[model samples]
Target: MAKIIPFKAVRPTRDKVTLVASRSYQSYTQAELEARMDYNPFSFLHIVNPGYKYHKDIKGKDRYTLVKNRYLEFKEDGIFIQDEKPSYYIYKIVNRDGLTFSGIIAAAGTEDYQTDVIKKHEDTIEYRENIFKDYLKTVGFNAEPVLLTYPDNKIVANIISEIQKERSEYEFTTTYRDTHYLWKLDDKDSIRTISLEFEKMKTIYIADGHHRSASSVLLAEQLKSENKKHTGNEPYNYFMSFLIPESELKIHEFNRLVKDLNGLSKETFLIKLDAIFRIENRGNQLYEPSKKHHFSMYLDGDFYSLFLRKNNDAFKTALDALDTQILYKKVLEPILGISDLRNDTRIAYSHGKNDMATIKSKVDSGEFAVGFGLVAITVKELKAIADEGLTMPPKSTYIEPKLRSGVTIYEF
Candidate 1:
């Protein structure tokens, strides 16, 4: 069973939240980052990029200490305040595309992660995990919560519907045009009800933030080993998470871009692909894959449809059945001579939100010789993969409702 607890989050004051909240630092280009630090005094960018204040770039432990200092300064200046009582936050985001996501923010048990009650479909890099664990140990807080999705529950849904009827504590729109709203559920009864409802769930799958969660768990274990009087109820025992129903998750597929067709001529390549797929010439009007096993291809200024021949491909596992994996096994490896999906320079990817025309343009520009579009994987497939303890291919899915940092902070 899942054990979720409320936390007294350190959040930006209502007046500064609109300005203080920011997308992850890496998302911004150097110029955009400089512009934010120059014009937006209250932006969370100032805290993370503390070196900006001194007009020099800082890295590693030095930067971590400075980040802690900036965060404390924000608290001293009354830009941030901690809640008087532990509470679960109901956060809602309405994107520019009009997709709305609502979820509960709470401290989820690290024990659940250890026991596999909190599942993951992606692998985390140990080197990056250790780097972030060290940063968290120095800074002593987490601003961005890991996104977790569970099976839909009517009891939880009712609670959210009722809470959303009241006025929110923070309601603001970002320059990116997305509106964010947050409501506090500090009342004892409501908090218990929500927590108990989550306990009934068998498992929750990580929709995003695999590395963050892994790092937090690593930090928790390290701290436990260091303290002789460690207790299970300490702050290190839990990490912040955004829990939503699986139905609310939006998944997109990654389109493949290859630099060349290996040594095979176009005619030979098509012949090899024909063994596993029924190829159709779509004549460049624009094509997109609409179903599992169906794929869209762009080659030599012409668009083609590749439908997996019935019963031609076999799957012994969930990963084996994935469209991306099928493409690799049948076309990329055996025919195109491209392997090592992670380190291979021959392959690149475009998001599903980017349409077929975007992929075609890349191939037409001589940057890539071919492009392949695949149907997005379903939530059922994702859960199945996680249940089997299997990791998906790199960049296999593009998830939505990308979160912001500094909206709420979980401190040790």
Candidate 2:
């Protein structure tokens, strides 16, 4: 069974939350980052990018120490405070597109991850995991929560609906026009109910943040080895997570763009694809795949729809049915000779939110030779993949709601 617990989160003052909450550091461009740090001293960017204050770029352990210092400064200056008691935070986000997401912010046990109770659909890079584990060790807190999804239960949903009827603790909108609300659930009865409901669940799937989750587990193992009197209930054993229902997850496909066709001419490439797909010329019109196993292709100033041939025997495993995997097997690898999706210089990905416009522009500008579009993977498909201990290719899915940093801090 899955294990989760509430923690006393350190959060910004209610009055300053609008200013202190920020998107991830990488989400901002250099100009936007500089402007926010220059104009808004209270912004959380000031905490993460502590080097900006000294006009120097800090790296490695030095940056981690500085990050901790900046965080402590915020608490000392009365901008941040710890909750009086452990509580599950009910967080909700309504994006600019008017899509709403609701979830509980709690600490998930690393043991659950180790035992496969907290399932994962994406693979994590070991070096990246180690880098973050070291940073977490020095900083001693997690500012962003990993996104997790669970089977929907009436007991939890009812509790959330009741609590939302009351005024929220933090209600503010970001510059991106996404409205966020957070409510504290400290009552023992409701907390127990939520805990019991989750305990009944057999597994929960990771919707995003694979590296963060892996790093937290690594940190837990390192801390356990160092402490002679380590307890299973130590803060290091748990990591912060935002738990939502499966239905609330928003998934988008990642369209592909290739710089070259592996020395094959346009006509020859189409001829090779004919063996696996029934090709239709879409001719200068932007086309998107409407169903699974179907694909939209853009090559040489025109669009084409490629349908998978019937009676094809590719479906052997959960991963095999995935459109991204299918593209790799039938086209990207055999036809184009591009094997490494992650390290290959010939391939690039665009989030489906951009649709085909970005792909069209990239190809039209002579930057890329061909582009491919795929339908977003369904929740059922994602669950099956994780259930069977399989991982998707890099950049297969773009998930939301993208969370904010410094909204709720998990301290060890």
Candidate 3:
């Protein structure tokens, strides 16, 4: 059986939650990063991206040491405190767009992950896995959670709803118009009950963070090798994870951008694509795919909807039926000659959260030649593929709520 546990997490104090919890460092641009460092003294970005603070001279140095030291400082400064007992945290976030989600933060076991009780759909890069493994080794703790989902479980739902009513330990709204609410499940009896409820669950899906979860498994293995008395029950055997119901999760598209037309003119490219697609020009307006076999294309400052009229037999496969899969098959492979999405130098992808205006702007400004906007893949597609023990096409899904760091820490 998959075993999940409640742990005494190191979390921000009530007053410092907003200040201490920040989005991932990569989310910020250089200018924005510098501005944050200058303005927000308590932002966790300083700990993760310390290079900006050391006059940018911290390059090639061990950043993990700085990260770990800063974490210790925060705890010593009373900015963060450990729970008195093992607890599950009720975390709720309402985005600026009014999309809301609430879930629990608990320790997810490596045994579960290895067993595919925690199913993964994305393929992790070996380089990224190692980089993150080293980062975890250096930082000595998990600051962000690997997002996971379970099929709707009534028992888990009842416990979360009942606990949320007892008043929250934290309730605050950010400047971005997103509200974050957290409740500490501090009682021993309650913790035991939550643990028991989750153990009954048959499977969990890795909704996001393949690299982080994979790295955690590797780190746990490394720790066991170095220590003689290592037990599976050690904190290292579990990683920080936020478990939400599958129904609560959202998936968005990862749009494609082509740097060049591969030496083909706009007219020539259209002629080539005409062999496979029935192209309808939407002109100067944003066009989204209305159905499965549809595509939204932006070329020379105009939008066009291309319909895949001829469905192939290969479309029945896990990777083939996908919109991104279709694009790879009929367009990227046959037309543009961009064979590999991961290693190819000709293409790039942007998340669905980036609006059509940005995609069009890049094409119109000569930064990119053309763009493709995709209708999002649903959680259904993800689960179906994972169930079949198959992986989705690269950059196929963009799952959000990317959780804030420094809010809750699970140390090994």
Candidate 4:
């Protein structure tokens, strides 16, 4: 069984939530980021980018101490205030695309993460875990929500619906054309009951934020080692997360752009792909892959689709069936000679928020030699991969609400 709990969250005063919240740091362009930090003195970005006031000599997360100090400053200024009591928050984000997602924000259990009860399909980088864990320890708070998923259960859905009628603590629509709503479930009996419902489940999968989850675990271990009286149920042992049902979750495409074709001409590459797949001539238009193991590629001023014919029927490997894997097995490895997507300088990824026109324009402007628009993986596939204890290629899925930070803080 999985155990999730409600806690007293430090949150921004309603008046400052708009200014305190922001998209993840990577989501902003250099110019856009500069403007945000410049214009909004209360922005949480200042904490994330504390180097601005510090020194050029100090870099990376070494400035975490400064960020923590700034957090204290916000509390002192009454910009952020801790809740009177423990509560569960209902968060709702409606994107410009007309998709609406709402879930409860609470502390998630990491006790059985290694046992695959709290499942994950992406491997964590040891270096990144150390970095974030150190930051969390210094700040003593969870500023971002770790995205997690659970299987479809009607009881869980009904519990959320029962809480839906209450007035939200924070409710507002943002400039990105997304409506965000948060309700404070302060009734102790209700929060306990909801937590009990979660414990009835056998598994909980992390849909995103492997690094943050790992950091929470590592930090919890340190606290336990330093203090013999430590309780396994402490707040530091868990992290803030928005637990959504797989049925409500949406995985958007993470598109790829290559700087060059590794000296292979377009015709030769097309011919090579034809040997194991069908080359679709969709012409110079947006041709999206419609199903699994299919890919849509825009190259050399034209668009075509590649259908991989290979399949392993005897062993139904979940990760193997991903379209991104099909690209790696067919195009990236044998054709392009780019083995590592992360370290390789040849490739880039665009989030689903970006349109296909950006891909076409980059190729047309001579910035990129080619672009590939991939079909998104299904939520069913994510669960299957996690169930099998398999990892996926980097940037395979882009899940969002791109949650606003500083609205709530789960503290030790």
Candidate 5:
């Protein structure tokens, strides 16, 4: 069973939360980071980008120590406070597109990840896992919560609906046009109810933040081994997570762009593709794939529809049947001579939110030779892949309710 618990979170002061909460550091462009650090004194960027004050880039263990110092400064300045009691945070996000997501922010047991109660569909780099684990050891807190999803439960949904009726403790809108609402579930009854509901669940899938989840487990292992009087109840044994129902997850596809069409000319490429797909000329009109095994391609100033030929490719596992893998196997490798999706300089990817015109423009600018659009994978497919111990290709899904850091922090 899944184990999730409330924690005494360190959070921004109620009044300053809107200013102090920030999107993940890497999400910001260099100019955006500089502007926020320069103009907004309360922005969380100031804490994470401590080097900005010294006008030097700090890295490794030094950067970690500086981050801890900067975090302390925030607490000392009365910008942040620790909750008096452990609480489960009910977080709701409504994006500019009118899509809404509601979740419970709690500490998920790292042992659950080890036992397959909390599952992952993506592989994590060991180097990244180690780097983040060491950083967590030095910094002593996690601000951004890993996203986890479970099968929708009516009882949990009803509980959330009732709690949301009350005025939220923190209600603010960010510059990104997303409104965030947070409510504390500190009362024993509410906390116990939510915990019990999760305990009844057999598994929860990692919707995003595979590395964060893995790193948290690594930190837990290291801390447990180092402490002579080890206790399973220690804070390091749990990682911060935002638990949402599968129905609330918003998934978008990552469209592909390639620099060249291998060595094949346009005519020869189409002929080679005909072996696996029923090709249709879509002319200059922007096309989008509407279903699985269907694809939209743009090349030489025109769009085309490529439908997978019935019973063409064999599927031995969930990973084998994924659209991304199929594209890599049939088209990217056999025709385009592109094998490594992650390291290939010949390729680029755009989120589905960006339309085909964006893909076309890149090709038109002579930066890429062709582009492909695909339908986003469904939550069901993601769960299936993870259940089978399978991982998706890089950038398989762009999940949202992209959280803000320093909103509710887990400190070890």
Candidate 6:
């Protein structure tokens, strides 16, 4: 069974939360990052980007040490405080688009990840994992929780609904216009009830933060080997996670862009694609795939819809049925000769949130030879892939709600 336990999170004071909670550092452009750090002293970016204060770019263990120092400074300055009691945090986000996501923030067992109780649908890079593991080991805290989704349960839902009735501990709006509300659930009975409900669940799926989860597990193993008095209940044994219902997950597709046609003429490429797809040209009109196994492509100033030829016996596993997989097998690999999706410079991905206009613009500007739009993968498909112990293609999903860092901190 899955294991989830409450922790006493270190959080920014209610008054400073709006300024302190920030989107992941990479999300910001260099100019935007500079502006925020210049104007907002309380922003968490200062802690992560410690070099900003020194006007130097710090790297490796030096950066890690400086990050730790900045975090301590925040606490000393009274911008952050720790809860005396262990409790589950009920966190809710209502984005500017008016979509809502609610979940519980707690510690999830690394053992659960090891034993497959906490499932994954994406593969993590080893070097990236090790880099983050080293950073976590030095910093000794995780400010960002991995996004996890579980099968919906009435018992857990009812508990969250009841707790939300009262005024939240932290209610603030970000510059993105997203409102965040957090309630502390420390009462013993309610904590027990939430714990019991989660314990009944067999598995949970990772929606985002695969590297964070993998690095946390790696750190736990390292810490266990080093400690002579190792105990299973140590903070290192679990990583922080935000657990929501599967239904609450918002998934978007990643449209593909290719720089060149892999030495093939546009007509020849269409001919090769025609072997697996029944093609139709929708000239000068924007189009997006409407269903599974269907795809929309923009090439040489026209849009085309490609339908998978019926009775193709390719789908043997959950991974095979994915639209991204189908596109790779039918077009990207065989027709275009672009096989390494991760490392290939010939290809790029844009999230569906950008819409077809971005795809058309990029292709029309001579940056890319063609662009392909796919229907978003469904929750059922995602769960099936995880359940089958399979990983999806890279960039297959663009998931939300994109969480904010420094909202809650889990320390070892």
lDDT (10s digit) by residue, model 5, range 1-412: 9999999999998899999999999999999999988888988888788899899998899989999999999999999999999999999999999999999999999999999999999988999999999999999999999999999998888888989999999999999899999998898988888889999999999999999999999999999999999979999999999999999999999999999988889999999989999999989888999999999999999999999998786799988889988998888987898888888899899999998899999999999999999989999899999999999999889999799999999999
lDDT of 1: 0.93
Candidate 4 TM-score to native: 0.94
Give the clash count for each candidate.
0, 0, 0, 0, 0, 0
Worst lDDT run of 10 residues, candidate 3, spans: 52-61
lDDT of model 5, residue 93: 97
TM-score of each: 0.98, 0.99, 0.95, 0.94, 0.99, 0.99
Question: Each model's C-alpha lDDT?
Answer: 0.93, 0.95, 0.85, 0.82, 0.93, 0.94
lDDT: worst 10-residue window of model 1: 310-319
For model 2, the local distance difference test gives 0.95
lDDT of 5: 0.93
List runs of model 2 lying over 4 Å from the truth: none
Q: Residue 290 lDDT in model 2?
A: 96
Weakest 10 consecutive residues of candidate 5 by summed lDDT: 311-320
lDDT of 2 at 55: 100
- Candidate 6 local lDDT, residue 196: 92
Query: How far does residue 344 in candidate 3 sit from its true spot (Å)?
Result: 3.1
Q: Residue 198 in candidate 6 has what lDDT?
A: 86
Number of backbone clashes in candidate 3: 0
Each candidate: RMSD = 1.1, 0.8, 1.8, 2.0, 0.9, 0.8
Put down candidate 2 lDDT per residue, 1-412, tens digits, no spaces. 8888999999999999999999999999999999999999999999899999899999999999999999999999999999999999999999999999999999999999999999999989999999999999999999999999999999999999999999999999998999999999999999999999999999999999999999999999999999999989999999999999999999999999999999999999999999999999989888999999999999998999999998664588999999999999899998898899999999999989998878999999999999999999988999999999999999999999999999999998
Q: Give candidate 2's total backbone clashes.
A: 0
Model 6's lDDT to the true fold? 0.94
